[model samples]
Target: MKRISAVIVNWNDKETLARCIRSLQQQTHGDIEIIVSDNASSDGSQAMVKEQFHETFLIENPDNLGFGTAVNRGFERASGDYLIFLNNDLEFAPDSFAILVDALESVPGIGAVIPKILYSQKQNAINSLGVNIHCTGIAYPRMLDEPDCDDLAPEEVACGGIFMMRREVYEELGGFDEDLFLYHEDHDLSWRIRLAGWRLLTNPRAVFHHRYHFNKGKMKYYHSEKNRLHLLLKYLELKSLVLLAPPLLLVELAQWAHSLMHGWFFLKLKSYGDLLDLLPRILVKRRRLQSRRAVADREIARLFSSDLQISGVQSLALDFFLNPLLKAYWLWIRRYL
Candidate 1:
């Protein structure tokens, strides 16, 4: 029998951490090993897990290493045929992990499985169905904040917050890019795994509740934009990059204007500057990715959208003007690639 390992990376969120652990304890899958990778929380999250969840394997770090690093640390200690990475702020339905495990086990070439995630505060609202990549190299969670429905199907990439992967595949792919630090780490991993000929799946029958918030600030924008650019730098094939460069520049200009309006202009600049500093390492990683690529650029391009569809981010003016132009440009470039 294939054993399951659940890894939860936590920080200062004690209440949510305990709640998440309790939900994991309720999983229908029997004797699953749970590992808590606590990132030096000041709120006693480590002690809470130790006292209340004695069965859990705990690794309390001395200092806060970012999300990707902590997750990597947890995976290093895991001993299961299938591994799950869960957020401390999530609560899984009793059968969620069982369903996910079944899906991956039954499917050939599936690298990971993500559960349908709905907002805990508002049951009708979705936190993520799966991720959708854009032509300009941005990735957004599909159906976010949309009314939850049972009609959605499997997608190209799993939701980062709630997902499971085959242990061997995860190790072979080198797991999450710790260089990403936090944001867009999933996309980087997903893209690489897909390139290496593995599919990411979604199991609608498996569901979880996420305590999500819009919570945006300059630092968030900085990491998101910075890591997004890093994803493009590290994975995009040469042909795709050349094809998408013009539109990417246009998008960058729009982003600069938006950031200026929101007093994040300096942060945006800092992201660009950071990318420049990180170029050498990015190029080395890109070479390795390109050399191992199994999927062609054309196939990957088919999965990318030319226009942003998520609400609040899309404007009537952008849809009316920018979106059309981007779509037309993508149509042109994608054909030749």
Candidate 2:
């Protein structure tokens, strides 16, 4: 029986956090320890954890640090053979951990695995299956909004962060990149794990319900685009980066057009400016990861899709023109990668 350390990152989600922790306790797998990583919640979440969940480990952050940072704090204190990083707004099934532990051990090459995430608001819809990778540095859940199927089996993915992994893989990858602060840290770390010759998968047998929302506003665009570039620098070798330069630039132009239409043009510019400023540090990390990685760029290129689709956002040019052009370009450039 492998012991699993579950780390739940919370910020002002006091009620949901308590429900999530209760769900973890009710798991059929009894060898799991829970850690609550509260990001300075003002809603009395820390106090509730300390008073009610006395057995659970609590890391009360001083301020509202981002998701990755909170999870890292929990990871530092976790003491189990396997680790599960999660959000506060989730509820696990009775045997979720047991099923996930079996899945992780079932494959020798799998570094991490995510469960079939179902939307709490929807009766029978799936929130995420396997996260898909795009050529234009985008990552999205492939089976989003699909009806749940009982026979759905496990599948490989570009990356999965609401995930469970062997403790050794956690030590090797050193968890999520704190520099990303909020978004795309999963993609950044996922690429590193893949480059290190480890695979990520989704086990549909284990189910977790999430309070998934579709928010296309706020700092989403800024953090997502900025961190997407951050990972691209750290993983792609020089030759691959140069070859990918054309499509990358074209994506930037299309991004600008979309931002302007959405009234977030200035925010997009700010993301670019931050990327420019962070270039020096990004390159340093890039060199370190590139030196130690076991896989080549070409191997990973095959995992990237050519389409750039965002749910709810529609554009005539994007669907008919940019998608096809990117698809063709990726087909040609990947051979040289």
Candidate 3:
């Protein structure tokens, strides 16, 4: 049997981490090595892992190195054929790892597999099957906060928090983009994986429970907006950009309007400023990624979803006004790709 290394990056969330560790210990797949990569958490998370889950490997960083970097640290130490990147705020079903591994191994050219994630408290509500990115570079889980829809198909991106990937593929792709730090890292990595001619799958047989919560803070909005724009600037082909320019501009306008209305105008402006400052460096990375792309821009374009799914109270103005326009614009431009 192939060994599986599960890495969980955590910061100041010890109680949930303990629950996550317990679930991993109960996995049916016995050759699993669990590693807890703590980001200098001050909540005694490191001590809990050291004492309570003594069998699990623990990496205590000197400071908070962010999610992607800390996970990379765990990836370097991993000796398994497959790697499972999981969030500390989750509980895996006994066969979750087994199911994901089986799906990945059975498929040709599949680099990763994500399980159906349901809310820990609301079992009937789906957290995510996987992830998808909109044409405007908004990454989201379609089933987030929605009742189970039974839509179990392959996805454009794997959910960031919990997914399994082949070790060799991950290494070849250089793992997650650390610059993203928190948000859209999965979308960016999965986009690269697809560009490298590897398919991603969603396995319904596998299951996990997430204690998911949507953050409304300025930092959350800032990283999301900034990284999304960064993703587009880096990977979106110039031709596609030319064709989609009008809609993209409109999306930006709408974003600005929404932010202003919601009192996040300054944060939104900060994201744009940061994006401008990082443009040159992002372009360099773009050249590197584009040079390595095994697929055409059009092929990558197909993976993006037409609709953007946001998890929060639905805005009547957005639903009745903005979304229809956005959907129509996407459908029109997608054919060109």
Could you give the C-alpha RMSD of every candidate to the true structure, in order shown? Answer: 1.7, 1.3, 1.8
Global local distance difference test of model 1: 0.82
- Candidate 3: where are CA atoms >4 Å away? 149-161
Give the top-scoring candidate (lDDT). 2
lDDT per residue for candidate 1 within 146-217, as digits (tens), equals 898878776655224357888987888898887778777777777877788888888877989998877576
TM-score of each: 0.95, 0.96, 0.95
For residue 47, model 2's alpha carbon misses the true position, in angstroms, by 1.4
Pairs that clash in candidate 1: none
* Candidate 2 colliding pairs, count: 0
Write candidate 3's Cα lDDT for 1-337 as tens digits.
9999999999999999999999999999979999999999998999888889878999998998888888899998899999988888899879888888888888888888878899988858888878867778877785676776555665545334367889988999998888888888777778888888887778877888888887887688788899988988988888888877876787788788778877889999999888998898899999998888898878777767777656553677667776788888878877777
- Order of candidates by TM-score, top first? 2, 1, 3
Off by over 4 Å in 1: 155-161, 309-314
Q: Identify the leading candidate in terms of TM-score.
A: 2
Candidate 2: Cα lDDT at 59 = 93
Q: How does model 3 score by TM-score?
A: 0.95
* Model 2 C-alpha lDDT per residue in residues 94-152, reported as the tens digit of each score: 99899989988888899988899999999989998767778767778878889999998
Which pairs, if any, clash in model 2? Answer: none
